[model samples]
Structure formats: structure tokens, C-alpha cells
Target: MLQHQDHLALRLALIANKRATVVRLRDERRIDDTVLRRLQATLDSEEVRLSGGAAVE
Candidate 1:
């Protein structure tokens, strides 16, 4: 049973945040590889938690 929806909401929020960050960085005419990697790592980590340690993709 999926009791709490926090994880799902957090995942959505992270996606929105990543989108915003990408747009901002793009408009600034510079992409920070470190920042992008960090965001991706955070997303992947959260997804792993959601999937109960199952492989993502």
C-alpha cells in the first residue's frame, strides 16, 4: 500500500526545479556541468528511494 505521497510530490518538485534551473542556466548562456550532474544525481537518488532499490530504467 502506498501510504504517504511525500515521495511522489518531492519527485515532481524536483522535476520542476530541474526544469527551472535548466532554463535559467540556458538564459545565462552558461551551463554548469557540476550543477547539472548534482541535480541528476539527486533525482536518481530520489527515484531509487521511490522504487524501493529497484534499478531505474
Candidate 2:
């Protein structure tokens, strides 16, 4: 069972990481459509997990 504040913190971290990845992808000129799509998917899933938006892990 995760606390709400802790969960929010986790979510923030996930967002920060995703942002970093996006920056890296952009900087490396590797931000292809497929890669962006996959990153979006992963970010969405992580948000769900952080929000208790999914079934128990």
C-alpha cells in the first residue's frame, strides 16, 4: 500500500524521467514516430501505476 504523497512523488519522478528521455531522444535526433509512441505508452502505463490506476502489482 503506497501513501498518496509518496505516490505523487513517484509520479513526478516518472514524468521527470520521461522528460529527460524526450530531451535525449530529441538531442540525439532519434525521436522517431515509433519511439515517441512507445515512450508515450510507457509514460501512460506508469501514470496508471502511480495513481493506483491499475490492478495490484
Q: Against the true structure, whose lDDT is highest?
A: 2
- Give residue 25's error in model 2 in angstroms: 2.2
For residues 1-57, what per-residue lDDT tens digits would candidate 1 score against the true structure?
Answer: 254577676676777687678758856868776776676777767777876898866
Q: Please, what is the TM-score per model? A: 0.51, 0.55
Q: Please give the lDDT score for candidate 1.
A: 0.72
How many steric overlaps are in each model, in order?
Answer: 0, 0
lDDT, each prediction: 0.72, 0.74
Best by TM-score: 2
Candidate 1: where is the Cα deviation over 4 Å? 1-30
- Cα lDDT for residue 6, model 1? 75
